[model samples]
Target: MTLTQSRRSGGRAARHALRSAPLAENVRPVRGGMTGGTLKALSDDEVLRIHKAALTVLDEIGLADAPPSGIEIMVNAGARLGDDGRLRFSPALVEDMLGKAARNITLYGREPAHDLNLSENRVHYGTAGAAVNMVDAEGRNYRHSTLQDLYDAARIADRLDNIHFLQRPMVARDLPDNLELDLNTLYACGTGTTKHIGTSITEPANAQACLDLAYAMAGGEDAFRARPFVSNSNCFVVPPLKFATESCQVMEACIRGGMPVLLLSAGMAGATAPATLAGAVVQAVAECLAGIVYVNAIQPGHPAIFGTWPFVVDLRTGAMSIGSGEQALLTAGCAQMHQFYGLPGGAAAGASDSKLPDMQAGWEQMCSNVMAGLSGLNMVYEAAGMHASLLGFCHESLILGDDIIGQALRCLKGIEVTDETLAIEAMREVCMGGPGHYLGVGETLARMETDYVYPFHGDRTSPKEWEENDKPDLIAGARARKEAILAMPCRAALNPALDREIRARFPIKL
Candidate 1:
């Protein structure tokens, strides 16, 4: 009987303390930006084939509707505009820009501790969505997501261990004005979390205001540029070879303002893009390659993510099946293309078509999350709390997603083959001289915290124990945790003086 066994047999208070104790950074079993890339959805030859197809798409089909400024920048960088007014890139030009594009970039957080290193197969999971509604699980209903809801979501994400970053998950429908909406979205997310934030702007004119706001938070223009805590999730292209003119302009402003950009190309198969999964991927790749060219032409080596978010459609009804197996395959395949380009890439995952956080949502969310991690996506966006095919956001789901992503990251960590991990000596000791079992052993006790990730909300109780106590509900557990976290005194994400100053100067809704 050891101290560990004594605590193990102790009541719920001891177990809670043990589970709640934080581990040192070096010893944590899974963490943000763990190296994955073990599962290849596409072979090298297949990757090459898709690469060639994408290049061909750019060379022949090209992209239409680039903003005039974008046209000038790309043209000077060797892209050609044809009589059809479509911007076409030569294979050589695409290759040149790809080579010039920034690699191994860092997405900074307000705190240095939360910075993410984006290179190769390093994987990080986080939230992203434009859900207009918030799910009320207890009421079994939904309401328009408000600025306060967005703030609460960010605050919750700030405390979740497995969620790596915070992106604006829902629209502040309460703020009717677009400019107010944009500013408040940034304000809410930034003020709620010290982690890196991702957001979007409605207009190019709002870009300078955003930069100014960030500067105020960072203390100065140079300081903000040196470590941009927020990035613009710019949907620069509208599927199937077309530039979103306004978004392209917004991209230019944010890029010149020293903000990193996510070159998002969200093409829904069967509606906005090709019905075939491979064709959808090809179009997305081509569009993002053109985006790489656009970003590099403006400022060579500018930080940008190769975001290829392709959604699936049932085809029969034409509604998006965001949690379908096809969606997972699409995300995995897009991640492979990102690896092929050797660029930091992102894709959608963990979104569920199910209206509620039920068994369906569980299967849908886990399937994509696990596959995305296995496929080594650099940024797995919309990886938590998304419901109704991304129309609704749930705070409780976000809390549970921390646990889900922890398990996904453990899978990504895989097996460590080492002398100690081999356990042959321990096996011999247990079988011969020592006890016949490995339980209660020193190695087991030592490795317990470092080698395993226990879910805070997930139950592993025996039937007897479950009956002995009241049967714990999973949703109830997550809701209680959420309430506990939200009840704590909110950490000031920006200095009190700075926050007051900004509020005085601008509309700080949060």
Candidate 2:
């Protein structure tokens, strides 16, 4: 062949080789636990002011409605119970507990590869919520979410590269009994994905049963404790300085049973919390600081997430405006508090008020997710597939959210300015001697996969190509990807014998 023909053939072969190459874990464009925090929602002085305000709230206002067990525990650990039945904390005691709280903790997945390291400004996105309904894309209607839907969501999340972990997102409304519901929720989520699983326990009595299931799945108690694959997403506190009675007890049990806890303080602004943005943030921070004190008192250095999930409400309607810009500020501001304490923390983001995954949903989800990542929120819960102000979970949306998160993470990864990345030498080569453009250059080919994040379902075809391919729909693309994933057998990590044993022991609805 002539020289030009040979170069064309060689270029085609090189391109094919690059396409077939495997991406090493270290060089992938984005993955879990990317460091962010470039976006400071609160200035340094502002962060300090918020800290002092939260401490004052804890010291003076205090929280009420602590359970008997909690009251005894804290009373023994420097907290005082008032005659009016409020639990008061001192600044000294709060600081001591903060020092003892775990930092830079690793949340392990069943398959060690999926473990997430939460440290300084490290970000990880995952699914979460207790939505009671599921949006059926094909039927185009809302229906009660069952255990099947929860399991299916986990199945989809398992294959998505951007979703770091799996939290029980939807409630299994089909089961009426609380114990049955909690057990099935754990079983379904644990078995559905090998990634670390999280769920809430209704009653303290069921904590051991859930731990027993974890132990059985992990081969023994020691094995499970060494790297606990499940975490308890405990809503330990109610808004405005009050402890959730039963939820606190559940948190105590889980901590003793070797389960990491997410100290979730979900207060709605203009409703359960203060209407002012700074005031809402103050309440969330104070409530979570109390949780930190509680967890450290129970067991010092216990792995607990400072989850300040303060939500927003439309002032006129008093309904939660989760998709609004105010909600993004609440979440981002809370992340600053987590950084202030130097503790691993989480906050809600990527939820939408829109009912479906339309243009509205896209803008809303992207807004908070990008802000949350930029603020360096450790665990961005409900970062995918939530709608109707968190009342509904959409599978197609969850599928599409994977693509959305991939792009968001790319932003968090930010621009690396190394000698190689500067591309000075490559630019000189192209400008000085080679082709007018850099499209077919070696530097361009080598950096293509590592320098950018391409969407799995996002349409990027030219008009002619789009027309040739029948003008594929976005939601249709997501639905097709969802079906392709679910078409395979279940991806549960539990072996058949252990799975059968757990099934026989508990009322596992899935």
* lDDT digits (tens) for residues 292-343 of candidate 1: 9999999999999999999998999989999999999999999999988899
Q: Which regions of candidate 2 fall more than 4 Å away from where they truly are?
A: 1-22
Q: Local distance difference test, per candidate?
A: 0.92, 0.92
Steric clashes per prediction: 0, 0
Model 1 lowest lDDT segment of ten = 6-15
Which regions of candidate 1 fall more than 4 Å away from where they truly are? 1-8, 11-16
Candidate 2 residue lDDT tens string, 1-510: 689968876986786577447689899999899998999888999999999999898888899999999999998999988888999999999999999999999999999999999999999999999999999767778999999899899999998889999998999999999989989898888888999999999888888888898888888999999999999999999887899999999999999999999999999999999999999999999999999999999999999999999999899998899999999999999998899899999999999999989999999999999999999999999999999999999999998999899899999999999999899999899989878789969999888889888777788767975896799998888889899999988777578888888889888877
Listed in order, each prediction's TM-score against the native is 0.97, 0.96
TM-score of 2: 0.96
> What's the CA error at residue 53 for candidate 1, in Å?
0.3
lDDT of 2: 0.92
Error of 2 at 299 (Å): 0.6
